[model samples]
Target: MVSKKVTVKNPTGLHLRPAGILCNEAMKYQSQITFVYDGGMANAKSVLSVLGACVKCGNEIELTCEGVDEQEALDHLVAAIDSGLGE
Candidate 1:
């Protein structure tokens, strides 16, 4: 398992569109991906779950992945978040 802690930089946070992007990127891997925010955890592969986590700008979240492709998954997802979900 691998994990990355990131502060959300997007002004809008992890809303529907960014959640969808995260989910899509997550789906490309076999790793089990999860994001934890404010003590709430959500599967990264589910847009609704991510959105429901209520992560907002400047909020810190932990992205974790466990499986064969954990490193790649973590790298991609973290990069996505670090990029403000390409806002």
Candidate 2:
């Protein structure tokens, strides 16, 4: 398992567009991608789950990936989030 802390940088947070982007990114890998925010855990590959977390801009989340490609998944996800998830 691999995990990294990242802050949501997009102004609108994980709304529909950004959340959809996040989910699409997560679906590329076989690893299980998830994030913990506000005491709740969300499946990164699921747009509804991410949106349900209500992660606002500036909120910190611990992204986790576990599976055969955990490291790569973690790195890619962290980078995506760092890049503002395409804003």
Candidate 3:
């Protein structure tokens, strides 16, 4: 398993668009991707799951990936989030 802490940089938070982008990115890997936020964990490959977390801008999340490509998945996700998830 691999994990990293990242803060949401999108001004609007993980709204529909960013959430979708996150889910899309997550789907690119075979690893199980999830994020811990607000004392809860949400599947990164599911838009609904991410949106339901209500992660706002500046909120910190611990992204975790476990599977064959865990490291790569974690790296990609952390970079994506760091880049504002294409916001």
lDDT for every model?
A: 0.92, 0.93, 0.95
lDDT tens string, model 3, 1-87? 989999999999999999999999999999999999997999999999999999999999999999999999999889999999888
- Backbone collision count in every prediction? 0, 0, 0
Q: Which consecutive 10 residues in model 3 have the weakest lDDT in total?
A: 72-81
TM-score of each: 0.96, 0.97, 0.97
Candidate 2, 1-87: lDDT as tens digits: 989999999998999999998999999999999999997999999989999999999999999999999999999988998998886
**What residue pairs are clashing in model 1?**
none
**Prediction 3 global C-alpha lDDT:** 0.95
Model 1 misplaced regions, further than 4 Å: none
| lDDT (Cα, tens digit) per residue for candidate 1, span 31-80 | 99998889789999998899899898999999999999999999988998
Q: In lDDT terms, how accurate is model 2?
A: 0.93
CA lDDT, candidate 2, residue 4? 92
Better of 2 and 3 by lDDT: 3
